[model samples]
Target: MAAKRILIIDDEADVREIAKVSLEITKNWDVATAASGEEGVTLASTYHPDAILLDVMMPKVDGLATLVKLNENINTCKIPVILLTATIRLATQPAYVEAGAKAVLIKPFDPALLGGQIESVLGW
Candidate 1:
């Protein structure tokens, strides 16, 4: 099997670094990082990652808006998106589901389990 390509969008530099290193080292996945939702959307359309790990809160465009923009683009509409939040219980949230997020993962996640969580949610 090929390495899974993942795009992580977050405003916090530390968060992005942590997730990027974690995913690359733990899962051997090709990971991309974007510091904002707009950048993430742009990257998604071109990079065409297998999945996107999007931050819920952002300055201009949030994850929900990014998801919508991604869905609107033909090149990126099919990629699965998973929302990341510092808060909890978004997995059961209607708005996130309605916004096209496949799942919601909490912050401070176990790096070792991140791949498993994504695989389980996406049926990878």
Candidate 2:
């Protein structure tokens, strides 16, 4: 099978790097990362990744806003997005799903299990 391509969008440099390495090492997937929502959106359109790991908090364009832009764009709407965030109240999961995220993953996740979490979310 062709290696799955994933894009990770996070404001924290360490978060981005950790996720990137975790996916690449554990799943042998092709991973690209962006430090901000704007760059993430642009990459999503052009890179056309199979999935996106999006951080819920960002400076200018937060995850919710970024998800809206992605859903609004023809090129990126179909790619499933999984929200990577610090724990939110469980009640908000449905809200995030309604906003277009496939799943909500808590931050500080175990690096070794990141790909599996994504696979479960995306049904890969």
The TM-score leader among the candidates is 2
Model 1: per-residue Cα lDDT at residue 82: 95
> How do the predictions measure up, each by TM-score?
0.93, 0.97
What is the C-alpha lDDT profile of model 1 across 1-124, one tens digit per residue? Answer: 9999999999999989888898898889999999998899899988989999999888899888898998899999999999998876635478889889899898888888898898899998
* Model 2 global lDDT (CA atoms, 0 to 1): 0.94
Model 2, residue 67: distance off in Å is: 0.3
Candidate 1 residues lying further than 4 Å off, grouped into runs, are 89-92
Worst 10 residues of 1 by lDDT: 85-94
TM-score of structure candidate 1: 0.93
Clashes of 1: 0
